[model samples]
Target chain A: MEMKFPMKKFIFYKRRTANFVMLSLSLLAALITIVPLVFIFYYTISKGISNLNIDFFTKLPTPVGETGGGMVNAIVGTIILIAIGGGIGIPVGIMSGTYLSEFGKNKFGILVRFFTDVLSGIPSIVVGVVAYTLVVIPMKHFSALAGGIALAILMIPTITRTTEEMIKLVPQSYREAGLALGIPKWKITVMIVLKTAWKGIATGILLGLSRAAGETAPLLFTSLGNRFWSTDIFQPIASLTVYIYQYSTAPFKDWNDQAWTAALALILLISVLSLVFRIITRSKYKA
Target chain B: MVVNEQVNITTEKTKSPHIAGSSLKISVKELSVFFGKTKVLSDININIFERKVLAIIGPSGCGKSTFLRSLNRMNEEVGGNFTGKIIFDDEDIMKLDPVYLRRRIGMVFQKPNPFPTMSIANNVVAGLRMNGFRDKKKLKEIVETSLRQAALWDEVKDILHESGANISGGQQQRLCIARTIAMQPEVILMDEPASALDPISTAKIEELIFELKKKYTIIIVTHNMQQASRVSDYTAFFYMGKLIEMDKTIKIFTDPELKQTEDYISGRFG
Candidate 1:
């Protein structure tokens, strides 16, 4: 097992060289991943910041060939759509996730989990079609409700799975402690298990919100993109993503400029959502 | 022979001041436990005296924890199947509601598990609060009393609103004990409660156990032999899921009737 001193030094150099090479390769890979994100942010901000002004946020889109207007209606419509989606998705996701983690250890649980994975993989366009048939067709028009429903369907799987994982991350000892106190199973799941994992679950919700906010395909057919201010759930509603899609494709230069601004605003909206949730759920004590 | 020894101990225990008028709080008859197809405990029979601390000591995998958990039906939470009767106040405990039974027979685990999301005061009263008890003044009183009983109040009184997990390990364990005490259970089960604690904390817990048994019957499972001797009035030695011996603590430590018990306690072998 003994090696000569010269051989040992040679081996050490070779090992050190391998370590250096691997570290450089990993650093290269990390840079490769970050480069595209940096480019996208840089391009979006530079092209969008010039068009962004107080009017861009306060006024409705101008008539065709007219110059000065904002996407205020689209912005408001997007918020309403997100509110509806969250109203439907958050409770369903949390309850189902709680069910899966706490009581779903059997065949039914496995089946439900499998279906959730499948649902997450289904194309957003296909969900749009499903919402089209279920809501738009039934109501006889493309509406904000249909778009919200489509987003809710898209959000459910992310929220459900993340919630289950987060709840599972809570130590088994916490459940045992609750049970030993003679608290009911439902109470323990709600008050102790859910409370402990809320920070993680909030992040999951934020992920779902960001994904839904960025969706263009689903809202394209479901909301159908209105030109005027409209807040009614039954009427067509404009959203930032849909406006970005419509304006970016039009031949007009100003519409294309506004599209970039809409993209920036969409990103800002998600960032604000994340910040608000962080502030709301911030831990009061050092952990 | 072991059954005859148990009878002698019962008769002898009746003479001690601590056991002079204390009645049988729980009786296990031919108890056995299984997790799926694997048996973990078999054909166990024991009588627990009221207001006395009975310690179960053995090597790892001897099913002492399973036995302690079975007392409160917490074993069923981990999917354990059981056979035979456990009588509490002349009723088969298996037929009783597991929730109600657990309320009557609370447990403290080997690791301190104060609810991390709760404040120190809130953790003490979590059981009551969760069960629909909403009286604020009563809850405050219960929190103070339970904290005092668990011997953690003075150290944590000023920081009652801090997170339960924001304390030292021993304090957290004592906080868990206070949480259990808030329920005012008839029995408290401790599963290697102080094995995770330092010596000073271990002494504090042992002293708490001594004070607690004046009101609640206790069953503790421990790997530490000296801890069993120091805290328990009666000690039962288990080897390979079987109770090798049960007797007064002094006898178990000084003059155990079985060779296995003597060997295990003297550190000859587990």
Candidate 2:
């Protein structure tokens, strides 16, 4: 009973060693994941930086094997496709997500969530085929509208699920505060619940958009690729992803170089989007 | 006004041992609450009087919050069902639309829950706008008055444009109070409003409660016996889903009728 234990010695050393090992392991894992990202930036930047210039952004693609060309039309088409896709997807996703979180708390909501998950898991190429049959066949041509539809379908579930999760993250107390003021349930959802989660919802939209921006398989059959500067959404349109796919696969050396530059442009667009959403999420608490 | 008519009608017929002939604002009759299957409050009856501070005091899990929330049907939000009759003023509140009824009997929760997405001015004016009051001059007057009444206007008058969350904990609670008062409810239900605050803030809230009693009948559920005694005119003690005793705050602390009340007031068991 009088024997004194080793004063904070035995457990302290053990805990310190264990903490060190775990910390090192975590650091290793982080580096391992970051290494691949660094490698991607390395290759894309090294290969693409030299090809980027004014003509690369402004001029139309020269015929097949030409030395100098740009994807100006493809860039414009991608922006239009994203606009149409996001316009169609974001509002519907937010509303459906609101219903799921706020009012649609029954068996039907569970089924809706399950179906949405399954839809997201479906292959993008398969979705492209489905769009080919649904829109391309009826219209008798592959148009930018069809491509936009395919991208919108991909975005809806991703946005919907994220919106629902973000809305759920809002404290129930906020809703109660709104209801205590005799605000209608729908009004409460829109004014209080949705406003509180708006940043998170916007992040979800950006993610969906970024995913849509990089997609190639879905647009291959839907938009079917274009070579000219076309403003008509009903007509076939070119996108950065489609141009990359076409040029990278072609035997022409110059076309492959243009494809690398197009890839860089897309990467920059997505990173900028990701950065904006990140800042929005960060500053939301300040608001 | 209907409460005045009821006071006249029941002035002679009622036989009450404590607080006799108090003009009743709300009458609870055969009230019982159940969360799905488990019963919480059982056949509780009390007369909440005109512009009075009624403190519902009990230990944790004693159905105190349940009983308080039941008054304004706020319990429904948490899936609590009650089988009873609560006559608010002269009307049975059970039949009234909950949204309309809540505007008349507003609630402040345990935590200070000001709308975080709004400015301080907007938070105070939220209920007024929800009720379709758009006159900016009148809205500004209500905002100033309510904040002043809650004792927060002096500190925050310059920063009305700031977000509700950009304030101290005590100030946030006061802002929530201002928000509720802007609604101009006849009855304000507070579930441990001062429980989350420090001593100084608690004292401030108690003083606000005393001042608020001039216009509103306040029902505050507090676990602190000292707080109950300090702020409330009438105190109702609850124990194990039953009304143990209810009397003037002085009598409840000094000499309660029930043994459990004495045990709790003496800090025997929470």
Candidate 3:
């Protein structure tokens, strides 16, 4: 006996319709996710572009009622603060990270890892208060050094965790190859394993630096903001984020406009940092 | 040399099962390996001849690789424990510093693992550079000679500074061989060196082995029976963590004393 069954036609048409509906939904969700970012960029550029000029970059702030001025000191101050922070943070972070990945298989290592995770979760304002008591109170004054210390503390946990994870991404076979060649364990970690993970480590550094650049609460109680030109580490320093905070709250319309321009400058600085790093660490093997 | 004295002493005590002109290079006695609670290789004894190829052939999970790694203490890297006396140049290798010992006896792994971060020329000289050999001219000479010996110089000379990984699989394996050769070790241990390569590449590696033994004592672990017979002067058969039989390659293939060896060679069972 022969058996017969019904075969549904246009089943492919149904699948195609379902696929189109799902694709459209995902595209809509992705566009919704970018709405806030697009709005921020739109407002920042439109309000800030009119106020941007040579004087906005080169000249010092004027007294009340006088409008034409720049944030040169603030720009230089941010650079110095970052340099100081990175000077303290990069080596400490990389070394500790190396220890965690290469030799941190014991209880002490687990404790250190836990503490770093907790440290990264601590509020930025809390770090500012800690720096206030540790550096500002002891020195009897707020200074650029205090701000730099706060930023360094914030940078360490991010850099350390990223470096450890990046180093772990290197294949175990590479370490074996180095050991089989009679190279010492330390040499292999530094020369081969660390070098192999360098691009990722650099990305971590950039992330930490970018976070430090945008921080205002940490700089509030530490550096305490400056109005005059100063390069001294022991003296108070100005930063763009601090200026944005102060000017945005001021009654004057010009200061409020300048705040938007300062935000634009901050964004540009971070962009330049990322571009420089991308060039420096670009792979030569890309075909 | 200390090696000459040890060879004379070993030849006097051991029966003459070696090739006519070859002398002992490495002698293993009471060797066993364990990983935690599991035993990998049982007590084994074998003699490796100077400048001669010895192939350790066995099926999967037969502890042939365990025996090869034990020669240079690379087993220690993976937390393997061993109980044995491996005499190299009259020195008990277990008592020697592993770093210094490994320099005298280098190894090539089953896969081609050139350092991806380094260029071809740099990969060839990584061991020397890391050991603080800074002579530029001599380093260049070693780069050329080592690549030539590994049969890769002609293929890669034009792109010496290219990344070590940006090459064909066979070229990369040959590059790893060149890297091991650059160290100028007295002995070379290969753990299934050509198993990861294509047929033509495997044949090229076999030819390189023939040329290499004249300058270094070679011990190779292989699963291919024909490869063992074609490239090795002597062969050792391993099964269930024990050495079942060992003899001249031709004799082992033609008329092995053990039935297991005959059974495996005839494709009866692994």
lDDT of each: 0.90, 0.87, 0.90
Given candidate 1, what's the lDDT at residue A145? 95
lDDT of 3 at A43: 92
Model 3: how far residue B148 lies from native, Å: 0.7
Instruction: Kindly report the docking quality category of candidate 1.
Output: medium
Is candidate 2 or 3 superior in TM-score? Answer: 3
Report how far residue A78 has shifted in candidate 2, in Å: 0.7
Model 3 reproduces a share of the real contacts of: 0.64
lDDT of 3 at B232: 91
Model 3, position A127: C-alpha lDDT score: 98
Candidate 3: the clashing residue pairs are none
Worst 10 residues of 3 chain B by lDDT: B7-16
What order do candidates take by TM-score, descending?
1, 3, 2
Structure candidate 2, residue pairs in collision:
none
lDDT of 2 by residue, B52-105 (tens): 889999888999988888877888988899887999978999889999998999
**TM-score, one value per model:** 0.95, 0.93, 0.94
Q: Residue A108 lDDT in model 2?
A: 97
In terms of lDDT, which candidate is stronger, 1 or 2? 1
